[model samples]
Target chain A: MGELEKIREARKKWQEKYEKSCTERDALFQSISGVPVKPLYTPEDAEGLDYLRDLGLPGEYPFTRGVRQNMYRGRLWTMRLFSGLGTAMDSNRRYHFLLDHGTTGLSVAFHMPTIMGVDSDNPRARGEVGRCGVAIDSLEDMEVLFDGIPLEKVSTSMTINAPAAILLALYIGVAEKQGVGPDKITGTIQNDILKEYIAQKSWIFPPEPSMRIITDILAFCSEHVPRWNTISISGYHIREAGSTAAQELAFTLADGLAYVEAGVKAGLDVDAFAPRLSFFFDAHLDFFEEIAKFRAARRIWAREMKERFKAKKTESLLLRFHTQTAGCSLTAQQPENNIVRTAFEALSGVLGGTQSLHTNSMDETLALPSEKAAQIALRTQQIIAFESGAADTIDPLAGSYYVESLTDRLEKQAYEYFERIEKLGGVVKAIERGFFQKEISDAAYRYQKEIEQKKRIIVGVNDYVVENEKVEIPVLVIDPEVERIQVARVKALREKRDNDAVKRRLEELKKAAAGSENLMAPILEASRAYATLGEIVDVLKSVFGEFKEIPVF
Target chain B: MERKVRVLVGKPGLDGHDRGAKVVASALRDAGMEVIYTGLHQTPEMIVEAAVQEDVDVVGLSILSGAHMALFPRVLELLKEKGVDDVLVTGGGIIPESDMEKLGKLGVGKLFGPGAPTGEIADYIREWFKSSSRAKG
Candidate 1:
């Protein structure tokens, strides 16, 4: 027999033993996402695999390895701790602290009221101002958010979906104040509204108008900023909302495809803004599966952007993403164990070659992270980059027989998801018909059942028993005075601003919103005119009114 | 025979994140409770109006954007003024326990933390209703 045949025979012999042994040990026979674990992978599993066509080199086409050459070796992945809860000034201080502690970027979290486009003093926004995230009632709050931080230096990511364009305009207005033109600023707004209808549910207007707003932002960003990411298409919230890995990949990429179509319909070229269109994914506790999902996402996006979307540039194909450790995996019982879970998830993000990463604080399962807990989260990333030696190589797990097979399988599964969504008439249509909602509901039900039945064990929750151990972690409490001070400030600002100018700007804003003009420019103008968020939203509401989601199930 | 407890799950204010509200609603329904979801973007007045109109035994408000401090008190106040003081008011979200305690003092029945099981929430509602019925009797 030939040398190759002899080696193949030996591998097959080992595989037979492995399959027999798998019958003995049931643990290796299953995966978290419910995919069955096979005994062995071979050249047969990777049949018809063209390395150049499928797995190209780092920084090349089909960027499944890494988006850039010398990814972390060039410079470590941006450590963006998702911070922003309470007043804008409070969040701004946290931003400076993160940047000072070697963070490469900023991720803004908005409060619920702000997310809904309500002003701080609005009866609706009363207690919510600066609660879950930084409150931005007007341009003043935006200016306070980026106080000393130069907009030209570090990248900032805002996690605002429904009011994304308004917030983006506020961000641009803030940058312009610093004498930096649109071309000099680089960052992303989580402006994905389709996913809002699918999973997150932070939607404002109806689907038709919401898509128009997204396209308007895409068009504006493509023409002006050029470097700023118009939309960070997100799957993080979807997974956190109870989607399995395949659902996350499929639903997220479907949303991406919908955005591309919307941009194209908006008279924008595919290559113009495709490079700046980024993604945000969740790094769950399932190690290899998460890594495989990331790899599959890159490969699928690259292939679709090239062949399907007819993109010419390699940058147009790469899916540069920011990953946050799964908050759902953390437990309030033994909060300390969350640190370990976050570390593993962060490691998975690094291995998956995330362009940037956010290691969730251990206290996240409870409240917003205290400064001390936030520091430990940052240190987790630092240890991975500086100490663990995991960042030393590009795509360290690239050639693993199991990993490659899993990546291929996940890619195939995601394609199946795409087909199913397409059959249901694309993402928006599917969401309207409650397709994605039903899938996620079923997945969540199954996962919850698994936990209840002890089939899937969460340490400290379902399996490991810790009795009456008092946690001594110092929890940060936002002073109740924050609400009192915020109310007073808004009251003062309302008293100071010109009522006539505010009314006039709002009228113009309503008129613009009523027509086909981009509401973002008006929102910015209104903000400059010292318009409060509620005032701007109230104007739009006068025209567009409030969105009422008809719950399907 | 006792009537099945009916609870209304509502998202008040502008916060649009409804995954938690939907999940809790489903869990409540699964636990043999009649759930009237008020959909999204409900104002405090609208929620109270719905609670009275729907004639629910309980009103459960879910908000993840941390607006419960202001919004919860308003909802509770509206319920009292509307002469629906017997209608149990509960909250579920990322509320700090201390705030929950403060809210409790203001007559917010209970606060369910993250990962709280559906059965526990259902049981709490049942017990509250049972006690209310006994007092009325």
Candidate 2:
């Protein structure tokens, strides 16, 4: 008999003997994404996995093993903390503090005003300025944000979507003042607008204009900011929006493919832009499933880039990503337990061969990470890198029977979603049809039902009873004074800067935005002339028009 | 025939974390309540207008952005100004216990935090509707 037939025969016999004596628990035996999980997985489970075709060696075509050959053995993944909070100076201080304590890279978390492309003084921005992240209104705020730190040295990642071009211009403006050229500046802009429509809901312009802005960035960055990652096509928000793992994988890759098509149609070479493209994903609580998802993501992205886009460069085919421990997985009840949760998630990211990582702080469920909690969060990553021996090898869980089988299953599920999305026109049209939104909502509701039905047990919440559990962890409170300071600063900037120059630059931007021109130059000019983010966004909003979602539940 | 408890689920401010709000909204709908969801980025004025227009009996404002202290009270004040005083004002997010108490004193109903069950939220709205003056009438 063949080896596979022998294993199947043995497995059937074992199951038959064990089934009568051992009954399964009365619970849902499924992955978090609802993929059914059997009690045992053997060699037969990985029967169809062709080693070379499905998963090549590290750093090869169809990179399911790891993107880099040596992975963490050569250089450890960048420990970037997604932080910001209050004024530019305040966030700058936090940056220095983080840098001092082993954080390798900087990920700026802009406040709602900045993210929404509004100024602090805007009435819509009231009560929200500097509440969640640092408020950057102009190049002045950006300069203060990077005051002591040199842009040429440390890599920065800005989490800005809608007004991503404006923020990128501001960063370039700051780099110029620091005597650093655009070529020398290295960073990433979360310039992903498609996901904003699908999940994050921070969109400004409608889909067409938004894609135009993104392609413009792609074209400009390929020529000038070659070292910069123009867009970090993200699945973090989609998963955080309560999408199943399959949905996150499929939707994110679909968005990536859409961007490639947009760039190609706009007369840009796929190789020139695709190499600079990056991704960001969430490392949720599902241990092996998260690992499988990451492996599958690398494989699918590699195949799609090569087969569909005909990306010739190896760098273009390789999928590089940053992973953040899921914030949605944290709990307000027994907040400290979140530390353990984050550590495990971060470990999965490492084992799955992430290029960069951000671990959530324990107190994040209740408030922003307090100083102590942020320190502990940073320490958690350090412990994993050093103490846990998790980073000693690359793609450590690549060949396990259950993991390989789950990876194949996730890959198949993602392909099924891809077909459905294609059937509904594409990602943008599917979004308009509320296809992705409805799927996510249904999955979210199902997960909630499971918890409520006592099928799933969440420690410290549904199952673990803690009577009058007093949260002892310190929560960071954003002082209301931060808003006052930011509002005053933006007002002062408008007063001090050359109004006529700002007006001329903004007019140039408005005109450029109206025509079929690369917007980066005009936007960079506006940023250099001290134009506010809100002013820039307002100009484009007038030309491109705003997007209003139909609000799917 | 009985009147279904009417609830307006509002996402105030710019924070787009609507997983909790949407889950609770559908759960309320499943529980046989009339739910009017005012979608993302609804200002206090927009929320109050929707509440009065929908004639909702309960207004649940979900603000995960730390703007709750500023947003929650403004919503209450707007509802009062609109002469829509009968509706209940309650919501959930990453609100501290101290802030919840302060909002409670200012006429906001019992506020929930993270990890709160959807069933718990539905129960709270149902109990509030049962004891409310609208139910008595």
* Worst window of 10 by summed lDDT in candidate 1 chain A: A22-31
User: Best candidate per TM-score, number?
Assistant: 2
Report the Cα lDDT for residue A414, model 2: 93
The regions of model 1 sitting more than 4 angstroms off are A1-29, A39-44, A498-504, A518-520, B126-137
lDDT of each residue in A237-302, candidate 1, tens digit only: 889888888889988998998999888887889998798899999999889999999999999999
Model 2: colliding residue pairs: none
State the lDDT of candidate 2 residue by residue for A216-308, as single tens digits: 999999999999999999999999989999899989999999999999999999999999999999999899999999999999999999999
Cα DockQ of the candidate 1 complex:
0.54
Instruction: Give Cα distance to truth, residue A207, candidate 1, Å.
Output: 1.5
